[model samples]
Target: MPPPASSQSCAPAPAPAYRGRFAPSPTGDLHPGSLMAALGSWLLARGAGGEWLVRIEDLDPPREVPGAADRQLAALRAFGLHPDGPVVRQSERGDLYRRALDRLLADGHAFECHCSRADLAATGGIHRRCVATTRRPRPAVRLRVAPDARVAFEDLVRGPQVQDVGATVGDFVLLRADGYWAYQLAVVVDDAAQGITDVVRGADLLDSTGRQILLQRALGLPVTRHAHLPLVTGADGRKLSKSESARPVDPTDPLPALRRAWAALGQDPAALAGADRVTDLLPAARTAFRPQLIGRGDTAS
Candidate 1:
């Protein structure tokens, strides 16, 4: 991902003073990538004098490993990132999501589908799954992806991103066949509900931007700034992810890890040295933070 700024004539659109959140699925512990995201987002919000919040994206129970949320919070604290308010638990917001689904259904922006992955994989993931099913159970909810649906925006870092939501993502799931609320739906609901106006996140989620934009349009949520930083990858060249057994960031000893991560990302960790307190660090980051300090492709930073 290209860095957000150039060293010359910087005219950054003000980082919104609205609330922002770092929502991580409880499928795994926080890792280096997670820390980078937490650091960037936390610093951005706090620097803008806005609320920095955390949300536990734990709506899917089968995929969620127990205690991952606690480990994640501990890791953030170890990194000196303290959230502004109590964490939001997606699992506890089922009624909210269900009500949203009913609203969307009544509004005709979404439809129910009963297609299996094997069934859709045959049609290159675009064919309707419930077209043949006469059942009224409404197995899963999918945004009725318009054939020409394209979402475009200028990312704060990776500028000029344009993606076709219907083609790249197809009629994406808002709810799963297993009765679990999907990530895209839950995330959009939470971000709007929480008043998030800036999204400083990993490049792995770059594609999700198109779908999220669609959700924002359907739900009439405010447009948030998007900054997609390159994701950290393993030695194998694959992007680091929870499913890959990536080593979790140490929640107890965040300094060494943050130091190593800063150096790894090519950012000068010493810039943040001699801080008065943990809370002071974020202000220092946002004030002195130069988005152009690092390049694309992350081992860190």
Candidate 2:
């Protein structure tokens, strides 16, 4: 593995350099919504001629089904989304995560807390309470956010935005009460660890981007280009979820889904009518992968 990002790592990490990855948590079968994200992220990295990696976000194995990650990979293969590097599994990197967490805790960037869902709700969501109350460690680790500090970053798709992460997201958790690695800490370390210079994912993760940026800043790691695509909601106007029993993506027939996703993104799938297979569709997308070409309105799955 390459060396982890340190004080000597490049500032802002040069564009069209380093790598990008699609880290999917295998809670269930891949769905249309999931495929859109994979396609978008894959195209983003490929268009840049950079390395593309795949990672199974299986840190929370309790939530992971027995064969879900492999099944997800099978779907990606069927859809022709191949990675340039070996796939990484979060479950296999526990030591790395533990080291990162310990560093954050020792540096005063994180602390131990026993706040439960109800304990946090009682204080209007962990805001202002962390400053006044000192709770003993029962099971979780919470990051320390300066109450007045603001985290600002630019989005390639959504443009410039600013958030007082400390106030808005509150002092977030790094390790959950159940001992699972929190998405915030895991993703931050993983991005730097993976040498990702660009992060292209669904827009629903926009809020989390600020927190990731904060963690990067704290660690002195380089910031990457962040682009959050328009969310793919369901017909019911809700986020399409595997838990809600969203229709499983048919890996055998990725064509229909690809066409539908293009339409959903407001792109003209018929523009390349002769595209009959995965290889043909990918080339078409790479040639026509203009972010501005994506329609401006919201679309539900």
Using lDDT as the measure, which candidate wins? Answer: 2
Clashing pairs in 2: 233-301
Off by over 4 Å in 1: 1-16, 128-138, 242-245, 264-266, 273-286
Alpha carbon lDDT of each predicted model: 0.72, 0.76
- Model 2 off-target regions past 4 Å? 1-18, 131-137, 242-245, 295-297
Best TM-score among the predictions, by candidate number: 2
RMSD of 1: 8.2
Q: What is the lDDT of candidate 2?
A: 0.76
* True-vs-predicted CA distance for residue 22, candidate 2, Å: 1.2
